[model samples]
Target: MFHTDCPAREVVDHVTSRWGVWVLISLRSNDLRFYELRESIRGISEKMLAQTLRALVQDGLVWRQVEPTTPPQVTYGLTEFGREVGESLAELFDRITQRLSPRDAG
Candidate 1:
């Protein structure tokens, strides 16, 4: 790990990336398999979903567990560090929604 005074930019890339934010939020609800995550996150293509997961996995923010079943299953969930990011993002979402709740009428 390269030493840095602050890694805010790297954190932003992991948290605010198109799929990164969503994937983190989705995992906050519960652990989900690869396809399950894809389905839970609507409007996202499989390729993008796979790509995002790979990035998160590499960052050590998302944990991937494989279950040996007949066909095998893989689940993704947030690591402890990821949970903090998820909570922060969730609060931001709530604030945005509260602020935009009304005033769309003529």
Candidate 2:
């Protein structure tokens, strides 16, 4: 029988990607529209945001919802799986921050 490789590698790559992590962390706050995410994540180029969102969506970490109303409203939010991933990353960030306080930064 044919079997596939572990999906962890891909998931890690997607979630840990430079923009991917920020996007996930930002979305952790609440569902955000495309422009809202762009604005919230300052200095993130439009191209990078688009690409990151696409990759996250492919990894099933981000849920993109589109409404057919005029002007077409699209919002992005963390899926249940993504929330778990985001929480883990958030904890890692907190630990790293605590480890690297002003004393360590100096």
Candidate 3:
């Protein structure tokens, strides 16, 4: 459905989905482990977070690295392309949040 014709719409949908926006903005600063991301993003269910990460990975916007270890450490970070997109999303997130604040609304 997304890839039918408008590639821009597909990218916008991926970047702006509820959890997708938060995920991209969260990863803008540093690489984070699965639990770290879960903790950082309040109110996100485990299933939803997993699904969001999977979609971002499929979109080439996030990188999933699995290290060799006893339990196997997994971390996520943005790709170069993702970083560029993430920065834009971050700015948008900030602007929206600020504009919607009580003081700003008043």
- Cα shift from native, residue 34, model 1 (Å): 1.5
The whole-model lDDT of each prediction reads 0.84, 0.89, 0.90
**Residue 77 of candidate 3: its Cα lDDT?**
99
How would the candidate models be sorted by lDDT, starting from the highest?
3, 2, 1
Per-prediction backbone clash count: 0, 0, 0
TM-score of 3: 0.84
Model 1 lDDT per residue over 13-59, tens place: 76788888889988998999989899888889999988888878887
Which window of ten consecutive residues has the lowest lDDT sum in model 2? 1-10
Sorted by TM-score (best first), the order is 3, 2, 1
Can you write out model 3's per-residue Cα lDDT over 10-47, one digit (the tens) per residue?
76778888899899989999999999999999999999
lDDT of 2 by residue, 83-103 (tens): 999988888877887889788
How many Å off is the CA of 45 in candidate 1?
0.8
Candidate 3 lDDT (Cα, 0 to 1): 0.90
Best by lDDT: 3
